[model samples]
Target: MTSGPASSPITDELLVGALELERTDRGVLPHRLPAWARAQCFGGQAEGAQLAMAEAQPAGVRLALRTAATTVELDVVRTRKLYRGVPPRPDGVYDLLIDGKLAAQATATGGDAIHIDMSTGESHVERGPAATLTFTDLPAGEKDVELWLPHNEQAELVDLRADAPVAPVPRTGRRVWLHHGSSISQGSNAASASATWPAVAAASADVDLLNLGYSGAMMLDPFVARIFRDTPADALSLEIGINIVNGDTMRTRTFTPAVHGFLDTIREGHPTTPLSVVSPLYCPIHEDTPGPGTFDVEALREGRIRFTATGDPAEAKAGRLTLTVIRDALRRIVEQRSTHDPNLFYVDGLDLYGPADHDELPLPDALHPDDESHRRIGQRFAQRAFTA
Candidate 1:
């Protein structure tokens, strides 16, 4: 973490947002979930590496600097996961915003790659050459510049360098909007950090954002709700259903109370803040069928990875929750609450992506939306839900 002769180490003031940086032997790992939530995530068990990997991918973290430098360089050690038979996902994008507008994008050409056997779920790491992302030819005057981290990769920052010294940018004084959801919100297939649906909506709504979209996690957990209860947020939104269905973790009897409890906890701290409850997007596979979603064995046999619901739609009546069941429950819950709590609202996930969208956009994995769908969902969410 070097710096100019007169300045402190640039890494010391790297402007990490919504991430708690923990130093590691490699460098620094950015964790979205705080220490307490992390403890709860582990629950006195061993700190699970797989869960650690997921939370360490800094989906909304960035380095914002107000500086006058013609050239800037960032040293990053990225640990990328490679699944067998699946082409590698794109490198995490570094979106550079100068004066509040995207001016450039780049990716580190070298990093460590960990290959995982799909069948065995075992991983092996191969060390790779070092690479530095360099940005040059910047305008001279002091300007707000943000380097958005890749939403998909595990990036460890070793150093930051600039031709001139850098200073942290002041906040924009926008209201802070906190959001939570599943992989779709965590940015499953999104191309970049700034392009993630939540980031896009936050930009449109002009809010400082804290994204708690942990992939395969948003289980309507009490700890998550407690996190919201304590965070300083001017508004809140939760995208529910998909994860509940996929994990098959609970029946409707338990889910109803969980949703109510989740909301009650948030209301403890943010009694009057506008809160929006979003149902799941239209997913054909899970709309009627119950889940316990599993890998598509047939597709995997054909060398393609996909997901399928193992639970029958008939099981929904037996208390197993389907997307359809969850949506209806959420609508009813929000409707009942909104009569007395006028600030509460419900946005049908169908409005963001519905039967029409599922038809046209067709989730390729039968789970997550593609980049184009992400753009459309983000745009629609901004227009429909995000507002002062």
Candidate 2:
């Protein structure tokens, strides 16, 4: 292999979609949540640790520059989470885009690993060396380049080397759309970084994206609301309900006001911005069942991963939340709020992925959507929220 040219220092100007950059002993880590928000998470704290892990995945984050280089190399220290007994998770994918189109893809090998005991909720990390990812044979002219980081794993961008000097991409004046949601929005089972529904929607809608989708952690936290409140955006959207319901964190009495408070915080910063409050998609498992969703131990022992709701269906009568209950409440909230705040709107998640669509493109894990479903949802969301 031909040795690439001198290394270029990765700077803040070259990154997009990340809210903060953390300098680590090995490299710089991209964070979707600002440092202040991350400060609230503690490794020893269950919910706090989950938020920290989710935010570090860098869902919509990418390095963008203009270069004439025919070869590009990026060194990274990647850390992936694995279950002790369940099937291993796939390696995170890195997508390289040239002039707005996907040109190539790569994955770093032998970086680091986190082994978790599902039953005990304990985890430990195994250290590994950094890996170099190289892409060769570009079109041989100055072009805009985007290196989208993995949306499912933690990656520390160690260094960059290229055949030619690179400069930051000039601003395109695209409207920025900041969104927050659950795992589906975090690209759960999506094929690549840009394939995540939110990323796809932003691209199709021709807007810049700032994705703050934390898997299993979208509980309308005050810190999260504060992040949205402080961030700048032309438009905003929230994919709420699934994480709340499945986590079984709150009932209607608490959830309704929490939604109001979340929106209230955001509106403090962006009073008139177009904000869409989206409810959960059609999840049959949680449609009428209250959760505290649990791992399917049988499936896990068989080396398959699956989730099943554990809450009683009868609990719905006592204001316990289900997908159906959440959706109805969200609709009413939007209707009531829209009278005074016209920019605030509601998009039923069913419109994006309902029963009819589910019949054809079922969620692979009975939770997260498959790649095709993500595409469909992205297309529908772009049309409903952007074009409309």
The TM-scores, one per candidate, come to 0.92, 0.97
Q: Which ten residues in a row have the lowest lDDT in candidate 2?
A: 38-47
Local distance difference test, candidate 1: 0.82
Q: Which candidate number would show the highest lDDT if scored against the true structure?
A: 2
Model 2 Cα shift for residue 260 (angstroms) = 0.5
lDDT per residue as tens, model 1, 151-269: 88878887777877788876657688889998899788787888889888888877777788877777887878988998888888999989889889889999989999999999999
lDDT for residue 214 in candidate 1, whole number 0-100: 78
| Candidate No. with top TM-score | 2
The local lDDT score (0 to 100) that residue 135 gets in candidate 2 is 91
Model 1 poorest ten-residue lDDT run: 1-10
> What is the Å distance of residue 336 in model 1 from its true position?
1.7
Candidate no. 2 TM-score: 0.97
Could you give the C-alpha RMSD of every candidate to the true structure, in order shown?
A: 2.8, 1.7
lDDT of 2 by residue, 87-144 (tens): 8767899999998899999999998999999779898999999999999998888899
What lDDT does each candidate get?
A: 0.82, 0.91
